[model samples]
Target chain A: MATFAVDKTKNTIRLTAMPKVLQGLTVITVLGLIVTLYLGYFNAGTDIQQGEIQRIFYIHMPTFFGAFTAFGATVLGGMLYLAKRDDKWDRLAVAGVEVGLALALINLITGSIWARPIWNTWWTWDPRLTSAAIMALTYAAYLMLRSGIDNLQTRRRFASVYGILAFSTVILTLVIIRIRPDTIHPVVIGASPQNAQGSFEATRGVVLALLPSLLFYSTIVPITLMWYRIRLENMLDVLEQKKIALLSEG
Target chain B: MNTPFFSVVMAIIRKDLQAELRSRELVATMLLFALLSVLAFSFALELDRLAREEVVSGVLWVTVIFASLLGLNRSMSIERENDSIDAMLLTPIPRSAIFVGKLVGNYLFTATVGIALLPLMTILYNINMLNLWVIATLLLGTLGICITGTLLAAMTVQTRAREALLPIVMLPVVLPILLAAVKATTGIINNAPVSDWQTWPQVLLIVDIIYLVLCLLMFSYVIEE
Candidate 1:
């Protein structure tokens, strides 16, 4: 059993134990990640053109979806925080940003690695790449601005609004390949742009390997990470309140 | 008695304009900054006539964006220092009216700087930046920038970092506007056919409307006590 309670007198949150669900989810996520990696490395068929470097695609594309899931939690958390004025929702929103940024970084690194052999460069200023870079920066700015404010309520309110607005960058990153005809980034699901480089068909082996990776990344990874982050934040709150209490007593 | 929405908006706008006219501080700083940036770009790039035509659109938008950031930070900090925002919130007029008023004032000042940059850029870059399409793109782009900037500046002004925080947060949000504006300006300057570049301005218009509606709806929440 887990205990998460707010003590009004001390003005702090007490979270005594990790929830069973979170622990179970963590185990499942770790196991799922390994299985997905194995499937990606061993089970998936090699691309006739690109060879083994293409294996990074399984991690590359799904981590973006992972980022998508995390940032979506941010938008939902932000909206709910604003409507209900709940600090827990605000915690969820910040957790979303931190997790989302990590996943987005993974997506970028994997893409860069994959691009070296496929696109023949470590990076390009394609629309998808530029937007993804900007998307990461936007959320990073969210964390910076959130820290600059000291007032709890005001910080929550402003962060909620900023978090909600930052989702626009995510949406733009996801759709830029579709809209920009000049991009050379590959599109796996639908028709690649006439100029797209390293485009590939999503064959059965590709789908079989990608589906579980996508499922684990988009669902379990972000959720498990965010749960731990939120718990850590609650502990930090308790520490902050204790410091304030000590100062007042002194 | 209920204050009419338009009248309230107009009154706030009038108040900001009147204050600006008396001091002439905001526009003067932004205009001076805009001029200096153009000069800096020209000296730094050292581009010949052909190269200038390719890069001048980017220079124009970048200058405008930085100038707008200066004006927005100044405008919002002024409100914060004087506690005028609180007084405005106390009034019965709609909260969004305050946003619209500040947006209009910021837009006008930034747009003036943008328009004035046209002839100077033409002279400096040796390209005809006085085209109608370029001016339209300028207006549409600035409106979108001001919409997001005003909302963001309000939040940043309350933070410890103040002016420095505004650009960090606002820049990425308004990047699509910057890209579209630069593209449109580049196309028009090069005299490209409408089929090639019309989509950029249309994108600018759509993004402007979306930001406008979003800022209006979100303004009251940001300013709440």
Candidate 2:
């Protein structure tokens, strides 16, 4: 009763049609992209101080939110994998991490680009930026650790546990920004930044641009990426199984 | 009566200490590495009078973290070398006890290396690195490292690139602890008010407890499969 089926003899999974979720997600993503580009170019008001560079917030903030959500999904997938020992959950966990890494990279680059004109430097050791860099490094280490492991079951198990453990960095990064007073990064939606420079309220034009950007980056974009990544993972698994079967048969 | 879990843990720690005492390999290398790291930092950076005072805390922590990686790698690899981990897994003792035992042993070895480096750092940096508050921070920080490092080392020991992978996996994860430790140490060295730096130890304590509990709960999975 599934939409896709794997042919064991041929070692290929055939999909009759795209799943409804993927199809719907694609439509929403296209619509969201057009709306975001329109708003970014037309509607969002330029900042009094930061000028046009502040427009990056439309994409930057949403990617930051999306990256956090991806990491959260990784934790959820990891916890479920541990409880159920399912390969699907492991696939979800890794896909979440990889997608999250890409999102985080985008968020960092945009934030850095935004910073260059405002903060007068491309990089500073601001607490939020520092923590983001560290978070990226931690997850990079997670993927590297996964590669070093050879056995399939053991790798899955260790990666799951590590996935859970590495989440501590994410928690620390999120919590530190609020609790600690050393950060110069603006707290957009929450408590005050220590030495806020260009923080602003979400004006009508800004919110119009931001809301759809959030819809795309935080939900539509990551889920679509996850869907494709999972499909690729399944195909890889099929090819690996076919190779093993062929070797044993010979 | 059979030995309790604590005694089992203590006994394992004793076995580790006795083996370390007999061979003196892990601590020796760790200490030498720590010392050499200090020399390298001093040579690489022109530690003038003000620079020496400011750089001591950062140098001390970076050295300790890397040196602890060396100790962590050896501690776990020793168990995995001769089918010993398999024998330990087969034993009647609880798996968490195995974790506690290795954790305690690693804590002691890393702590010793940290302590040994203090006097050398004091002499090289021309600032007194051997202060009470600094030692307290070092102990607290090393305790955090030992808990996480021991668990991660166990996971990495099963891999082919055991030595290379431990630091890569560990350093970033342990950055918060090192950051807090350095902050507290710097505050103390500069005679800043305790209120400014008090948050670091509290953060370190919370991080330590979180890592300890999670590593304990998760060790059974890592050791089993």
Candidate 3:
């Protein structure tokens, strides 16, 4: 099996080839997504009130957890990077933001799609909605600010600190529904607020379909994508070092 | 010679305040920017008197936030101009004392601008903005802004786009403070029951504490060589 290695003296990173394990996991994750889609569309019964539009819930809700998991990795990667001063952890942090952002965007877009039919508006200034939007912007700022720094070491350090602090937005987005009484966003697990709209019970088939999708999205999808991203970053670092060396020689 | 921590903090604060007193640049710019922002908001919003009362609080917080952004960027850039930050790092006192000192100086300047805006807004909008609760909310919210702003300003001042990056990075982080402050101010202005708006101030306090602690812990990391 090919392996990933970093040479300290030469300042180079090498990945001979894709590992068989990651290849297998990617295939498994794709297959899992297909199975979950089948279970959601074909196996689960339609809702009495919301009708055909409700199946999007399978993707909508799970993608949020997917985002939560990815952002959580960012916090972890940030802390580890700061403590160890390792470039690999910095790469992990960057990967987390990219993957987390994609998942968060999916969550927001799906929620809007679901809300259009049910709530009769594509967007509202509700607490939950606003916080989710802020959460996405916080990480988007992370990427923009990260690229604006020139020194690699300072970039990594500042990115770590900012990454750790930015998690507050994610926490706020998660808890805003529970804390703010006026939010119309529904809670799936617990008793939703009195004014919550479009909340449905988690029946057996719904649970069966949702559980696998949630597991796959929150675990397999983010891990696989972040792994690939980290590999790409390592390769980029190697190219950067080679360019510098060529410049010095010339 | 090892300088004591509190003394180090006081010295930094004294230095910043003395510099401002000599030139009157930071606070003057912030106050003027804040005043212009209030005027611009009033004209742009173009609300009726009743609607103006509802929106005046949002305008107040937004102006304070942007003004503080200006002060924060200038404050750190001054440190960078002559490598004053490196000199401070060579001192014997703890690094966090430097953070605390800069934080207090920034907080004081921003809070001054926020407090001055109260009466100006009251006269302009015909809403009672000089209440004690509103002032308290302003102090708490600006404290939160300065805490994060000081840390981020230090980071952004070292970047290619120094001034432009501060708001883009800071606004989303401080959105909670803006939400709480605006809610509290609006409720107070509308003469709502104490119970109606009390939680907003409490939220402001909690967020302020959280940002203060986080900034104190991370400030050294940001400014370190």
Candidate 3: CAPRI quality band = medium
lDDT of the structure predicted as candidate 1: 0.92
CA lDDT of A84 in candidate 1?
A: 97
Candidate 2 residue lDDT tens string, A27-106: 88888888888888788888787788888888888997788888888888888988899888999999989999999999
DockQ for the candidates, in order: 0.81, 0.71, 0.78
Predicted candidate 3 versus true structure: per-residue lDDT over B17-108, tens digit per residue:
99999999999999999999999998899899889978999999999999999999999999999999999999777889999999999999
The DockQ assigned to candidate 2 is 0.71
Question: Model-by-model lDDT, in order?
Answer: 0.92, 0.86, 0.92
DockQ head-to-head 1 vs 3, winner:
1
RMSD of 1: 2.2
Estimate the lDDT of model 3. 0.92
Chain A TM value for model 2: 0.91
Compared with the true structure, what per-residue lDDT tens digits does model 1 show for residues B1-225? Answer: 255888887887898899999999999999999999999999999878788888999999999999999999999999999999999888887888889989999999999999999999899888999999999999999999999999999999999999999999999999989988998999999999999999999999999998899889888888988
**TM-score for each predicted model, relative to the true structure:** 0.95, 0.93, 0.95
Shift of residue A138 alpha carbon in model 3, Å: 1.4
Docking class of 2: medium
Highest DockQ: give the candidate number: 1
Lowest summed-lDDT stretch of 10 residues in model 3 chain A?
Answer: A1-10
lDDT of 1 at B14: 91
